[model samples]
Target chain A: MWTFLVTEIMFFGGMFMAYIAYRHAYPLAFAAASQKLNIILGAINTTVLICSSMTMAMAVHSAALGKKNLLILFLIATLLLGGVFLGIKGVEYHDKWVHHEVPGPNFEFEGADAQHAALYFSLYFGLTGLHASHMIIGAVILIILIVKASKNQFSAHWYTPVEMFGLYWHFVDIVWIFLFPLLYLIDPRK
Target chain B: MSDHIVPVRVYWSVFITLLVMTVVTTSIAYIDLGPFNLLVAMTIAVFKATLVVLFFMHIKYSTNLTKAIVISGFVFLLVMVFFTMCDLLTRNITAPGR
Candidate 1:
């Protein structure tokens, strides 16, 4: 898991570098682009993800304690929180799609240095899209775990899968933790 | 395979701390700290991440080998970021035309 997270770090690290370089090159444009993002939604989503991480951690704890019902309950709660996050993200993306903020010919940022602003949206989609994909996968894993946990398949002696999934879910939450500030709260103009 | 079960109180406290930090970060972002804005935001973020890592992920209760592996991941990430920034920030200094 540690090795896999390292590779994931390198993966997201490159994009982070790109974002920093572009933000450095076009600070004003980046700021303007960032202002268009919905900070409230972003904060709420951050909280939701954090709560999900807590629930996931608790699920692992429950599994470790051989508490089958608590494990299933927490797993279900985590799954629901993950779904709410994606739902909010879908709303944000739909807003952008309607506003034509997506990076393409239809892309438009009514501000100085629109070109770099477009680059901001590009990274925005790339980073959040990847993060959301991980959330989807995590949700799927939680569903499977929920089923197995309901069947009393896990116990204190053998809950490695639950612990591993906790790591993965927390990692995903960590990614969003960074993404929230970088993408949403980065408005220098505010 | 030493399994340590963290108390619910720790998890709840960490969650509350993370939420508080999130609020603090958002408030700080609006304060116009000049160049310190980014630094402040990232510092808060790193702190929050540490809380998550230590408690939520149970790295604090992990074995020495597990800790070493996790620390190495961050070390390599630092190396990557540092070298990459060095190249990026110094590119103009060694430009062929300059």
Candidate 2:
């Protein structure tokens, strides 16, 4: 499982490299393009994800202490927070659609360096889209864990699921931690 | 980790640290620092991410093998990105003759 996650990190690392190159090479373009994204929404999403991370930590704590009910409550809290993050993300993506910021077809930016602007949107969609996919997977994993939890499949003695899930949840949170600034910060107009 | 629950205080501290990091990053974004801007922003982000991995993800309590694997993964990732970007960095603008 750890190896598999490392592989995923490598995948994202490739894109992050591309992001750095483009952002540095065309700083103005990337900034102008990036500024078009809704920072407010991004900030809010960051808050939501941070909250989710807290809940996930609590869930792991509950499992460690054999507090099944607390574990379930915190897990549900984490899940709801995951949903809230996705919900805000949806709104941002919708705004992009109306503004034609979703690259690959009729995307345009009214800023310095059109190509880099396009590149920004491309990265925006690409990174966030991948993150969103992970979130869905995380949610599914949680639902399963929740059900198993009811059956007492997890306890202080056997709770690898809780720990593993916490790891994944924290990972997702870390990704968004990076994403918040990369997508929302810096305006070329400045 | 053997059926021992980490305290609630740990969770609260993690939450507060994350929140503070978020604020710092956002504030830094509004300031202009030339090329250093991206560097500083990304550096702070890396710190925040590390915090999540260490505390929230319990990497601190994880086995040595797990830590080794994770670190190696990031090491290789950095290598891949760095080497690839080396070529990509020196494009048409900085030719020897030009």
Candidate 1 runs further than 4 Å off: none
Worst 10 residues of 1 chain B by lDDT: B1-10
lDDT of 1 by residue, B1-98 (tens): 45777999999999999999999898787788888888888888899999998999888988998889888888887887788778888999988998
TM-scores of the first chain across all predictions? 0.97, 0.94
Across A125-168, the per-residue lDDT of candidate 1 in tens digits comes to 99999999999999999999999888878999999889989999
State the lDDT of candidate 2 residue by residue for B5-94, as single tens digits: 467787798799888878777777777877776777788889888878777777777788889998998899888877877777666667
Q: What are the per-model DockQ values? A: 0.69, 0.65
Q: Per-residue alpha-carbon lDDT of model 2 for A81-101, expressed as tens digits?
A: 999988988988899888887
